[model samples]
Target: MLSKVITIAQQKGGTGKTTLAVHLALAFVKYHNLKVVIIDTDPQGSLGKWFMVRSKKNSLNKNLTFKTASLWGAQYESKTFKKDHDIIIIDTPPKIESDARPSIEAADLVLIPMTPSHVDFWATEAIIEIAKKAQKKVLVQINRANQRSKLINKTHEYINSIKVSATNIIIGNRQIYPSSMGEGKTAVEKQKKSKAVEEIKKLSEQILLELK
Candidate 1:
């Protein structure tokens, strides 16, 4: 079988879409020892920056390599990606433009990350509609959740009422995420055994199971 392509997308920014993509890619490489390639499709190139820093520091293992590719290059990259790689994770821009459409269309699964807010939820719906139209498997990751907040609980309930499969893994708001990313390190590597790493790991496992 061909490699599984996973696209991380969200119409609204600051939802940790790129963070999830990078950590998940690292998790697959670190834990499963899978040959993984990350396609930095976002114009911001957050994933690319992370890869560069990690490469400079020799933080990543030999099993993984993150490559930078334009949104327009997604089809070509996917076509030419090595069969030896276990998975290809694509980080898309924060809009539903023509460029972003191709990444979503080419993906085996589309993951939409959002916070527990009405605006974020609405934006997620728009993305989900597009994914549904493209006939792609769509999943939502609730990022930066506050367990004690009523809004978070309500948002979770609302998401469950929807037809899409919302991931049970909830990534809480943590200082480590912003602090470590500033140094070009992933939360998992910077704060090992922290809650943030554990949550991201669970999310990664759920994604792998779905792909399986």
Candidate 2:
């Protein structure tokens, strides 16, 4: 199958972009049984570090591939990966405004993760505009949020006001997400039957529909 590129982007830091990318990559590989390649375009190199840990633990997974590149380089690299992989995920650095276009343009979908805070709301529009200008599909992912917070309502309002699609499943502020990543495993791989695993599974299903 030809690969579909999904670029996880956020203009602000601490939005869990790297974590989301790795989780989604693993979900596609394990649950969907797809060949996945994740490209780390962020200079922070967090994704590469996680992949290294996973490699040592699993002796390098055959279904999952990890690579690094610049934002511009990712556009070219994702195209080449499409020949064999079923999914290509690019994790980008924070605060990359206009420089984010090459990566966004390469994506079949641009996923923007935001917490239910006013600060994250403020930081989201610039990247949304960039994705809009690039004529790419954009999905706002609500991450690390408390389910009962009133802010969740406001977040949906904000997404509607901005006129972008969002996933119906919100990634909760679950400990399993970060703790598993720290051990080079996903919730699906670590706990197997936890809420975090279910959230990722549903989110991955939603993303696959969007890609189709």
Best by lDDT: 2
Per-residue lDDT tens digits for candidate 1, residues 23-114, read: 78877877677888888877787777766776787674676767778877875687567466788888887866545777887788999888
In model 1, state the lDDT of residue 161. 73
Q: Evaluate model 1: give its lDDT.
A: 0.80
Instruction: Give Cα-based local distance difference scores for all models.
Output: 0.80, 0.92
Clashing pairs in 1: none
Candidate 2 whole-model C-alpha lDDT, 0 to 1: 0.92
Model 2 stretches astray by more than 4 angstroms: none
Q: What is the lDDT of residue 84 in candidate 1?
A: 68
Off by over 4 Å in 1: none
